[model samples]
Target: MTARTARAVDVPVAGGVLRVGVWDAAPDAPTILAVHGVTSSHLAWQLLAEELPGVRIVAPDLRGRGQSNAVAGPAGMAAHADDLAAVCAHLDIAPALVVAHSMGAFVAVVFAHRHPALVRRLLLVDGGLPLSAPADLSPDELVAAILGPTAARLSMRFADTAAYLRFWRDHPAFAADWSPELEDYLVYDLVPVADGGAALRPATSYATTVEDTVDMNTRPTVTEALDDLAVPTVLVTVPRGLQNETPGLYPPAHLAALLARYPAVEHVAWPEFNHYTVVLSRRGAARLAELVTAQLSLSVA
Candidate 1:
């Protein structure tokens, strides 16, 4: 396969610059801005970007991740939505469609809610609705159980880039279908650290983690925000999220309710996908692109 030329640019935002990746093809084609999950960067959409053709694809390294690490000021979805608005304005392209993965999906929903004028449609991959916790549990306990491993991974300063790639390969979710593109993604996500070592720079800080946990519980508010969303939207869910029973982790039921609430919402559940692979897997990426294309085609027709 020929390597497509990709460009990285930083667009100024409120507190800092938002790093954006452009997969430019045809200017007349519809534009799609990809919002990555928490602790993810523009590379999150690598596989999916490759599949989508003839479109101006904008993948922004959300605040505090990848090249956008400096724009970590936003504590919740609202803040991210605003940052996205700024980036869209900078690009001078109206929001064509938004395809968001995981936490990026949450930010995309909030963005569409806040700036309806910009978004023509929304494709939420394994995200969109907020996380939920048992009424009895404390947020601290929930976060530690659900996100502690991720926090630990980000904190690790790898001795070399290859070691980091190995770490991802050994992971339960990604081990089965690891590829060269994923290797490039892992390398891009890392930065050289002091003491002649490298580390993940877009590490989700404690503040951001806590903020996300809190925001996850704000599904009601997000629903209210989406109540009047004029833009069409779809939610794509993975099997792990629905079947896995890791305590303290957010459940898929919350997302179901959100889908039920919106007249314009559509939901798809793929049993073959895990939380991460829903956007990374070839089938999953094809499914995601198909959904977005189908929606856009319907709109244009």
Candidate 2:
């Protein structure tokens, strides 16, 4: 009397192989393509998938991360969007509803813009507008500030999964809430090194960081492309920045400006949640599901 586990499949794409995990529950159910943030993998949504009853969930390990790590770069938002499009095409599914968190939101936004016919709706979890970069800060300073000291502490290997998970949990964002699911996720984020110890697989390298940083700061052409897009869109802005310190990184002003431009888009602000937790926390997951399901219901009406 248990449900079936999600199926994992690999699809060949232009750049590299894509590892897609799919839950083919109901053919008529709205297919949700879940995209994780930077420095994360498909495992980010493992809990969300379990929470959604009969929805078909697809999460791909974006290029340069997870099983697609071997898949070399051009790891910008456009590239990631194209990768999602390719996956959808391979599956022969049209007009999928996309749920993307943080940096992944940028990817979904671009995909919806480029292939409007392919994306039925978009639910952005605490990421929508192009991230802004300080004009005066050098790239190095920015990376150091954002990544913290852990950015440069690239070790050849870890003693064990516990070691790596501890390092990951040590982050300021996750220091307080250490869930079992998070531990499992961090464990899979690494691979066994050649020397018999484990290191971060899909290791987020300096080059990858630089490329992601550049992409995050620059205004995506997709934002302009979606000007006339009629697909249902929602932006769930978090209460804080990535560091969880700033109270208004995803402020009402930011969402208001986007709504002013789009006119048809909907916006919601969750004052209780921070950037990462807005999508990862249990309450955040339920809120996201409610918002997305409501959108689906509206479309049916």
Candidate 3:
């Protein structure tokens, strides 16, 4: 069966409401709580939703990103985890499988730990493992260095949506895998600035992005969750980083050590894809759908 168009919903939470994208399959179909990256919106799961027609996919535009950019209070792993729990409570889904990408993976880990009863499994895509950081850099500097161009774009202003699309079209990571779905995702990220001009700016808050980046690196919640992890988790890594460069976020040796420490966690490497393409590309989404479907079957068995 072909997937249906996604429906948007606003779920109330502490401080503000979270805008969620729902790909409803059936009333009783297995639910997957998908989460996007730091700079992404719920639309990131569009391709994945199409790949799994029998499963219901729910993704939220986390506070400080996408349509939920106005959410109040601080942005951190703990706060995000709490918000996710509230979302699950609002949806009334128990033991849901969570599929998270990039920084979303960090949030998923903490959510599984904080609300163990709400999550049955975790699918971490290209994130969640401890990253190597320079101890000398401050939080702000760390964020700048880690995010690179992705962070730089937040401070920039575009003449129009077309200009923003042009910028992304030139990006090394997305240039080769460009598609209408990706264009839609980028278009949704743009918000009109109030300078009495036609130019638009990114919806993501710079302060929130910096705060979350720092928290992801220094937060104890992620490490604590890993230490006491009881949920079955699978991590999928790509061979390229955000810039489409080789020696991706998790190097082979680094991942091997991480797996050794967390022996219960399963790891899979997709050499053909990159950090962004893992969920944005057709092949990558298909592979992820297979994993989600297999896990859903296990959950019911």
Candidate 4:
């Protein structure tokens, strides 16, 4: 679909239909199920999809985000995993190579564990393992602790799409990797909302964000899934974080400890990319494309 232009397909899920963006390849082509970050939509994988033109990438707007924003109820690792399972069943694609970014990585781990027959392997970009934080924090506290300004932005209403684009354009993480394609993804994030006047808001549900963020770091579903996980998996991290600050999501010591605990998951780092750029930027997406091709080779070999 990257070469032919992408299209949307809705698949029924828990509370509503999950909106999936399909990038076409020949029917016989290998498929990649890509999962985006906490607040991101399927469009986050557009660059990566285009890079691997020969691959059919099915990226879904996880319930409570993107076009699936109306999807209701619980939003945790297991819930997201089941939503993914529904998408795969709807497409009749089992044993697909799963490539997930940020919180999506957490979902993939559980998905693979719960539906081992469906996922062949995983390429987790920028997130999957737990972050360094107190285990006793509440979902709201955790969202504030982990997301910081990102969580704050969700409450801010914008006059129009241009204002939202400007908000991201000024972000330190994206300052150097900005592109028109990136703008399209940003625009898609906005949805009209009644906030005192004519205004727009990010489609991501803050309540869902809190629930999922808390579950990723504090709940046993993620860590337990990781403990029992047998699928072949690789985790790739960047040097910078969401705002392009040093150390990124997983600092050296924290990352080393995680690797020691889950030696089954291989680790790799990309010095030139940040958390967001690893999937949204051109050069970073090219590097990711190379990794996907290599993983597909391993899956077949």
Candidate 5:
């Protein structure tokens, strides 16, 4: 087995630079693009990158999240889609398989729609379809309804990495699944803040999350992309939600309705994994690696 060497690169985008993590393999290794969930960075794919020994994985921090939070302009699915295209061009690794989790899945859809030639197939984990919510909810309630604690954490300021780690360790989604990798991922999400003290805060922007979240559920961008899905797509869903709650992001009945609408998109129901564990845990990474490996064996051209 080869050691996976990971490195970060800053690629120029519209407003600011996009931070990309490249898990390097052999020169001729198969390359695949990865997209992380809302409020997540390229580090979210670390465990999965290790599981794939001979493949190159390129992932970027979407604008308004992680290191790219400095990126100016409104955050939406189309904007993220364009940034991903820019990442591919900057690295010269286009036309690869896309493995995206949560909001990344939605971005992957728009990516495929906006840059069809750059996408081979899409592997959506625990997301991709619109997650319908009550239309009467206020903006705050809407973000809270979909993101749960994930959104609330954005507003919090921590004293340091240890403080942030403690906060995440208490999270139900990561409590029993704690690992060094999980710690590293959590630590990377924090940046120093100036709240009259040495406080640290998550790199994700709450306003940007609100914007992206609303666009994902209620905007025509997702609808238009789904209407014109032109590549091979496989949607893999988990049975649990972010807080280890049952029914996850895509409940069976709701997902069934979505699948019915986009009949060509294949669905794979994976049991015993929560939304975060689907990409955060080691076992989950191995299973997802198997799926990506299978897709690599096929020719999308």
Candidate 6:
């Protein structure tokens, strides 16, 4: 397959400029506005973009993550949703189909809710629905519980890019599925810290992550979005979690109960893939591209 080059464009928003990756297709091709997960960057969508060469893929490194990491502000669903809206307006692609993974799904949910006129359909991959969290848990505890080792790495320093690559090389989730693309994605997260030489750190702001996690789990926006969804929504779930463990982020029983409450959501389960691989791997991206194309067709039909 031919590789599609993504052009980086900085869009001015409320707080600051947002760096977005645009994979252009034919001028008339359908457009997909993609949002990445917490602690992730627009590079996360590279595989998916490659799989859908006929469609225009626009992904933003949402505030506090990726290239938008320098854009300062309080991060939450409302803030992210608003940023996404600005991206649409800046690109003149409002009312576009939105495909989001992990925490990005939560942001998309609130985005679709707050700006119904800007979203035509919603495709949520492994998130959007509220996860089960202990009510007594503090924000820090909640982030730790949900993110586990992923969150812990935010505070870690790597001697160099090789060391950072080694760190992720040992991660159980990507160990088996590691590829050149994954390596590039990991390298993109490394930023030089003030410690004498270079050190690896997640571009994502820790404070913003905490705030968004708390809002996703405890805020009213997510619940309100689910309660009054205005557009067709589909949720694609994987069998494994971030660590490649069984029962995944959303256990079958738990997801079933949540889906029962929001009957409007259409859920599809793809077994044998973990949360990260569900969108990162070649096979997973192929499947996701198929789903996106199908949904886009449905929207127009």
Best by lDDT: 4
Residue 103, candidate 5: C-alpha displacement in angstroms: 0.4
Each prediction's TM-score against the native?
0.88, 0.87, 0.97, 0.97, 0.97, 0.97
Local distance difference test values of all predictions, in order? 0.72, 0.71, 0.89, 0.90, 0.89, 0.89
Off by over 4 Å in 5: 1-3
> Candidate 3 regions off by >4 Å?
1-3
Clashing pairs in 6: 95-118
Clashing pairs in 3: none
Residues 154-184, candidate 3: write the lDDT tens digits.
9999999999999998989876788888899
Query: How well does candidate 3 match the true structure in TM-score terms?
Result: 0.97
Poorest 10 consecutive residues of model 1 by lDDT?
Answer: 241-250
Residue-pair clashes per candidate, as listed? 0, 0, 0, 3, 1, 1
- lDDT agreement of model 2 with the native: 0.71
- Score residue 176 of candidate 6 by CA lDDT: 70
The total of clashing pairs for model 5 equals: 1
> Candidate 2: which stretches are off by over 4 Å?
1-5, 136-138, 145-157, 194-202, 219-222, 226-228, 251-259
Tens-digit lDDT string for candidate 2 (1-301): 1233567889887767988888777778777889987777787876677667677888888877777777875777778888988998898876457888877887888888777778888888877565544566676676665554444643336777777776667676665656776776677667666555444433545566667656666545556656656677887887776666775455556566767877776778788777766666666666777776787677557
The local lDDT score (0 to 100) that residue 42 gets in candidate 5 is 92
* Tens-place lDDT digits, model 6, residues 20-74: 9999999888899999999899988899989988889999999988888888768
Candidate that beats the other on lDDT, 1 or 3, i.e. the better one: 3
* lDDT agreement of model 3 with the native: 0.89
Candidate 4's C-alpha runs over 4 A off are: 1-4, 195-197
Give the distance in Å from residue 176's predicted Cα in candidate 2 to where it truly belongs: 4.8
Ranking by TM-score: 6, 3, 4, 5, 1, 2
